[model samples]
Target: MSQYVEQGYTAFADHYGSSEIIFGQFRRSRQNTQRIVGATKWCVFRPTNPTRVVVEAAVQERLDRMQTDCIDLLQFHWQDYNDKGYLTALRHLQDLQQEGRITTLGLCNFDAIRTDEICCQLGPGSIVSNQVQFSLIDTRPLHGMADVCQRHNVRLLTYGTLCGGFLADQWLGQPEPDAYSGRLTPSQRKYLDMIVKAWGDWTLFQSLLVVLRQIGDRHGGVSIANVATRWVLDYPCVGAVIIGARLGVSEHRGDNSRVFTFQLTQEDNAAIDAVLEQSNGRHLITAIGDCGAEYR
Candidate 1:
């Protein structure tokens, strides 16, 4: 946390069960607090009603946890799309924002149509960003969500860009593991399943890795992860890509720096798009349904 903020990378932390550590870190340093952006989610696990009272309490708890006057971005997440309470919750959040309790408002895993409805209900420019699963493997956002966000001027904050580290060379040319093999971590297994289901066969994925390596070699041997991150970074409507940092456990500062060192060429884009064109099609998007369909 200290190293990253010191490196001029603005920290974005969420309030959850273990948020105390994050808040503690910032509380220890006013400078750190100033350098970080705090975001929290509502309706994490189906709040009974998501009423204004529930929304206010949740926001207040988050504020008290982070010990900040206002949250940088309050992202809302609701599992049941049919539940109308989500709009009411956002309205309360908007009221809180007016009272200076929130700096900005955002949505997490919201599909295009719903986001459009929310924008219409809130008038305009109500959402600054929509956090979503967006990557080479999960291009579902481009189907309609990207257009909706663009129409509403809502930027995209993406995740799963590295596909839980599967995009790296470490997994290139490797055989698919047995389900009970226990070789992959939970995250790796989850994203690998995405590859098998949403992406195509391992053979086609390896082809992508090969092309990424070729592009990297042209630009001074950047890692496959760097290429993956750079690819998503170049996508339209993306404001930021959330890379997980295992603070005090592991860090990728050096590898992450490569993302800024170079740019992808049109040739590189065409090569990637060619493989993508072959691996999957609108079918993948159909299977995924929409940006946040899995969660619902």
Candidate 2:
């Protein structure tokens, strides 16, 4: 559920910085305003593979647009597995850290194997997070990522936790769209359709909704996206879920924060487990290709 726009990195960063000023306009119009959430950094992961000097300049530019003196977390967008000079990029970031320009380092869309390689090579010079997609539907990380992060002490930042709003109750009883709206990319819709089919059609999805609603009612009203995000938060090394804000289009801040409001009970967990039992794993673990596979 990550967006890859090669040309406007600087502008995008600036727009997001200024987004807070205008969020209210849209929140009132289209978004749900029941959730309370907090400040989170949106790290850009790219394979422009800029030279260290260019990257350093670009990072500075982003900081300027963001109007922030320090980036709480700066995550590299992608890695060129064959080229292997990301070490140089990490070194540059480490130098920035010494200057107090960046507070923490992170990696986006990188697999466990490459993450270990980087850690072994750099010995922890500002690295702290590894952001990747992790859904109940796509539990590939459980195959090895959890153990790797434990050993290396790297926090994993999970994105697509809500699968671009496809994992919500809105779709439960509704007729399938000729194509889904509200998604910005074809890839996003593609995954939503995948989830629909994988989750056992519209009918079974309605059943899942009944379960989520029951859980929500017990917890004082949590949305399906909130539930999915909380589930991700329960995973090992998952510091947070990276949900898209879709500035000026929707505002889920309040609903998203219900994650902190109510704790999921053993009964709740068991309830979720019960629904998952009915899951048919037809589309479960095939490769979406690599990490951030949707973007590429």
Candidate 3:
């Protein structure tokens, strides 16, 4: 994000697990700090323990860590399926928004039904957005989340659009990854499992990659990742696609910036869809359940 901001590109940083480490990087680049949107998640406020004190402390801690007076977006995550305390947490977040501590309230990995329920409980136009795992391989949001979001005016801030880098040129013709491979990062291992579950085989995925490569060639030779990100960006209610820029380890700012330069044609959609349709005996929409189902 600091690199992107240095190049004058706007970035959003999430305070998920490593709040200090991630937000600390942004703090170092104070010159371009205003270009970044700071987001953080609340994990401990469950049905049994939700309280105003918890929300206030979490928000303050995030503000202190990010070195900001106000959070651009505060996203919440719930673990228990039967938890009803999420409603209380949202109310408190809304209060924080009114108090100028939070600019927007959003959800991470929330299913359609629960999202709708929250909207109703808080009244219309309650949620500003939702962040979820959305990609060609994980179109679960389309099953029902999109419609609910449309009704409630909640846009989807999508992640995993490239399936943890699996949907890139590097993996095009590679052999199926062994589960026990030491080379697989945790993200890669997780998404590879999703591919096997959503589609059926690695060979089929290679075929999809070939189609994406063909599409990329038609679009001035963009990478497979660009095509994948572009496809998700084009999905209904998708406000943005989150791509991981491994900071100093590697950078794709130049390639990623190209996603906005071209649009996918009808033919491009058809070619990609054809390969996906024949996978796993069903469309990704139904192959995976609604948004957040994988966690449930």
Best by TM-score: 1
lDDT for 75 (candidate 3): 84
lDDT of 3: 0.81
- Which residue ranges in model 2 land beyond 4 Å of their true spot? 1-50, 180-188, 197-200, 277-285
Candidate 3: list runs displaced more than 4 Å.
20-29, 32-34, 45-47, 281-288
Report how far off residue 88 is in candidate 3 (Å): 0.9
User: What ordering of candidates by lDDT runs from best to worst?
Assistant: 1, 3, 2
TM-score of each: 0.94, 0.75, 0.92
Q: lDDT values of the candidates?
A: 0.82, 0.63, 0.81
* Cand. 1 Cα-lDDT: 0.82
> Residues 1-296, candidate 3, lDDT per residue (tens digit)?
55677665765646656755567565655763275666677665335566899878888888777777788888888877677777887898899889998888888888898989888899877788888988888777887888998899999989888888899999988999896769888888888887886566888899999999999999999999999999989977898887876777757888888898889999999999899888763465465566777776
Residue 92 displacement (Å), model 3: 1.1
CA error at residue 173 for candidate 3, angstroms: 1.8
Give the poorly placed runs of model 1, Cα more than 4 Å off: 30-34
Model 2: per-residue Cα lDDT at residue 142? 64
Clashing residue pair totals per candidate (backbone < 3 A): 0, 7, 0
